[model samples]
Target chain A: MVKSKSWTMVKHFEGLPKLEDFKLEEKELPPLKDGELLLESVFLSVDPYMRPYSKRMMKPGDVMIGSQVARVVESKNPAFEVGTYHVTNVGWTTHFISDGAGFQSLPKEWPENLPRSLAVGAAGMPGYTAYFGLLEICNPKEGEVVLVNCAAGAVGSLVGQIAKIKGCKVVGSAGSDDKVTYLKEIGFDEAFNYKTVNSLEEALKNASPEGYDCYFENVGGNYADVALQQMKQFGRISVCGAISLYNDSVPATGPYIQTYMLFKQLRMEGFLVTRWMQRYPEAQKHLLKWIAEGKLKYHEHVTNGFENMPAGFIGMLTGENIGKAVIKV
Target chain B: MVKSKSWTMVKHFEGLPKLEDFKLEEKELPPLKDGELLLESVFLSVDPYMRPYSKRMMKPGDVMIGSQVARVVESKNPAFEVGTYHVTNVGWTTHFISDGAGFQSLPKEWPENLPRSLAVGAAGMPGYTAYFGLLEICNPKEGEVVLVNCAAGAVGSLVGQIAKIKGCKVVGSAGSDDKVTYLKEIGFDEAFNYKTVNSLEEALKNASPEGYDCYFENVGGNYADVALQQMKQFGRISVCGAISLYNDSVPATGPYIQTYMLFKQLRMEGFLVTRWMQRYPEAQKHLLKWIAEGKLKYHEHVTNGFENMPAGFIGMLTGENIGKAVIKV
Candidate 1:
């Protein structure tokens, strides 16, 4: 028998999540039955989605939901072998037993030097998110201006780089000067620290006076209100996240969008990455190829231990991470 | 020379327009040159759009912009014959000289018994607005549920009927009990008076417990906020007008929509009827055929005489009209 450690939510989050809101629990795992594999979580993901999703999908005392890259420690299943790595959504646990039903084994050709944590970061869910959200919804055309907020975060970072690959002029904003510098290094044509800017509207205008043709929206609320007005005629908006508004106990109020949408003939769509579940492999292939070619870059903010998972998640929500936030178990 | 009488805006409207904000002016028109035709306004349209458009497209002393069914009183242009009627966007003037370049002549097969005013109502811009806005943006599939507000007005009435023709279940809401009755008479599966409903949320829930698959939004602000919440997963919204917000001196504030939109994976697009300008004839043909087959119906709120044009426009903005509001000059 092996001991398993997991985190559970003490209560639904009211605003930003805090350390006290989580409780660490330990339990003894039973012997694995035939066809079952014992897996140890190597790296756990902490994302902005967990904040809003907690209110919608979790209850008090329930294990906090998430995904991880894990290694097969022992396997009785014929399809699996010991020491193979796979990505699994078994929540925030150090060890879990699975029948190998939904485990997604990492590609055999995964670059040897690359950290396996990326299976839950870029080249994984975030990569697929930026891939489909920007390409499918915004559909950026060559030479068009594309704007993305939270530009140094996992999804937004990839969104800007992908629009660049498609021949678009990419403009992005992040919360800190360092993140803005990182964005500039990653080939973003324009990058601004939204927190330091005197006015978001002027910052956006200075970046692209011709106005945006495609807006990959990650920060909603006042940022969205101003950004929406700058869309050129027939601009497309792909709403991937509303991190700024997610913490509000009540929904925020802002200027009605219908007038701008009408005059500009804008099309706005909201989507979840899971909507294209069947096409994940296709996105993963492209993401891998780009990384191998040095055309795509990824950064990770890895918290050293499973014990710091709550702090890492809280820090991520507060925008402390420049890229994917993950915990090493 | 013909003396033309027209109404001009005294100044930009601050809120709901007042009678003192308009001034009647008279001007003499020049003799027709070769290729020019003298036309007399027969019937003019007064629509909700005029309220907002006046601010964007007009200034003090400028004649209010509008479209009219006009008779060719005299013609130096060989393509147009005296006594033939055509639709022209020559604003509020009773008489004007045009080069016949952009005039659209009434269909040769137009039913003789129908009033020529229908050229500016059911067979004109409002009809095309409904035809394309709902069909193109919402794209209601057969057996899906559709919800439309302002259900007894020109575009809304047609939108509901067209959804039914497409084999979808339709629910509609109007401001008055009489308008609600009119919606029921037009074959709406469910109809309600929004003004009298205890709660818009309950009203929408009771009308269609399954939630709406398509929403045709004409009235925005609070109505849109409530209606957006009632949309089912993957629902589409066609934003045609925002009559509720048009009169506000400042844009109204409302609950942000991105959260609901994300969870439902909704698509919302705003459009003007002119977006489908080249396809107007296609829409008009279908509208005429449906009316001739008695599958479509039209009602006009005719405000008599040219002098009442401003009053007709104001009344329509105030929701006094049951259907297309027109001034018979």
Candidate 2:
């Protein structure tokens, strides 16, 4: 019998998620099935979408859902060999059994010096989400303006950079000066600390005076509405997430923009990276190439130990992470 | 001097527009310049979009903005021969002076059998809007389900028909029983009076067990939010207009849909027909062909005399018109 640790949702969150809402427990694996491979949790990813989707897609007693990069220590499936790294949707567990079907086998050609934790950060869901979401949905053209919110976070940071790669003028909104500086360092043409900004519309207009042609909306609420107004005709909005109103104590309102979209002729699309899972390897190929070329930069705010998953998730919710928030065991 | 009567906005309205809010003015037109043409209104089209844009885009004292099919009475511009028909952005005025740039000669292939008033309704902006907005943004795949609100209106009617032509199941929501029946008679898969439906969600669910794959949103507010929840994963929403909340005395408050869009991976795009004017000829090509092939149909709720423009506008807003509302002069 193998002992593994897992975090389970103990209670629903009303506002900010507390450490008490999650409880960690130890379990013993009975045995691996014929097609299942035993993965030893190495790094866990804490993302904002998990906060809302857990309340939606999971029962209270169910294990908290998330993704992690793990090493295949023992395998019943021939496709996954021992000592190979893989990205799997095994949740907040220290050990998990996954079939080769949905699990991705990370390339062994990856530079040995590069952190393997990036498999969940820049090179994993966050990276591909930014890549495909911007390239596919935003469909950015050269000289076009691309605006990203939460630009310091996991997905938004990469979104801005990728839009730049596609020959777009990238503008970003972050919560802090450090993140804004980091965004500027990463080739974002314009970056603002939305926390200090008095008016969202003024800040957005200042950053993008000509108006944004493509808006990557990871932050919803007032920021989105202001951005909606500043969009040029036929502009595209890629709605990856809405972190602002996820844990509201009461239903939220404002940015009253349902009508503006029609007059401005804007397009806002929400996407899940899984929608492009079929072409995930294709995305990884380009991402890996970008990393190899030093054209892509990834930052990780890792919380050490399995018991700290809640803290990591809470940290991410509060915008404590620079690029991607990860839990390392 | 030429005597021509016109309707001018006396003041902005508080709720539904009333006749008292407009002032009737008989103006003497000055002589046309050497390069200008004199136009006399023949047919006028009333649409819902004018209601909202007027408050923001128009000042306290400006000629009412609308498209009109007019006949040139006298011309110095060679393009406009006297007695020639043209579509001009000539507002609500009975007469106006324009150079060649203000008008386009009515297409020779234009159906003489069809009412010339349709050039402003079914075969004009509303018709072209439904064609492009639905096909391009919604992109309904075969066997997918499509839903449209205000289905008896000019834009909504055409949206439902286009979805049907694309081999998708079509459902529509109307404000009254007669319009509901008319939607079914025109071959809607399901048509319901939203006013009579006890629960919009239940009605939509019962109507779309498989879930709506494409939504042509003309009505905003709770109706859109409820329809949004019923959308299938990867659904597409074309934000054509929001007629439901157009006349609201106050702003609308409802559940925020940005979160739902992310989970469902839905795509919502807003569009105006003018953005595609570079391809305007193509719209005429497709809409005219569809009409000739009997794959498409048109309805006009004609009210005689131009004096009723305000009443016509209000009637259109209140959903009194079964289809396109036209004021025949």
User: Best by TM-score, which number?
Assistant: 1
Tens digit of per-residue lDDT, candidate 2, span A1-329: 88999999997777888999899999998799898888898999999989888888888868899988899989998888899998888789999777877777678887787888888888888998999999999999999999999999999989988888788999999999999999998889999999899888898889878998998988787677678889998899888888988988675777345687788878888988888889888888888778778778778898998888899899999998899999998
- Best candidate according to lDDT: 1
Candidate lDDT (C-alpha), each: 0.93, 0.87
Worst 10 residues of 1 chain A by lDDT: A101-110
- List clashing residue pairs in candidate 2: none
C-alpha positional error of residue B9 in candidate 2 after TM-score superposition, expressed in Å: 1.4
Which 10 successive residues of model 2 chain B have the least lDDT summed? Answer: B100-109
TM-scores, all models, native as reference: 0.99, 0.94
Candidate 2: where are CA atoms >4 Å away?
A: A30-37, A76-78, B30-36, B75-78, B248-250
What lDDT tens digits, residue by residue, belong to model 1 across residues B36-78?
9999999999888888899999889999999999999999999
In terms of docking quality, how is candidate 2 classified? medium
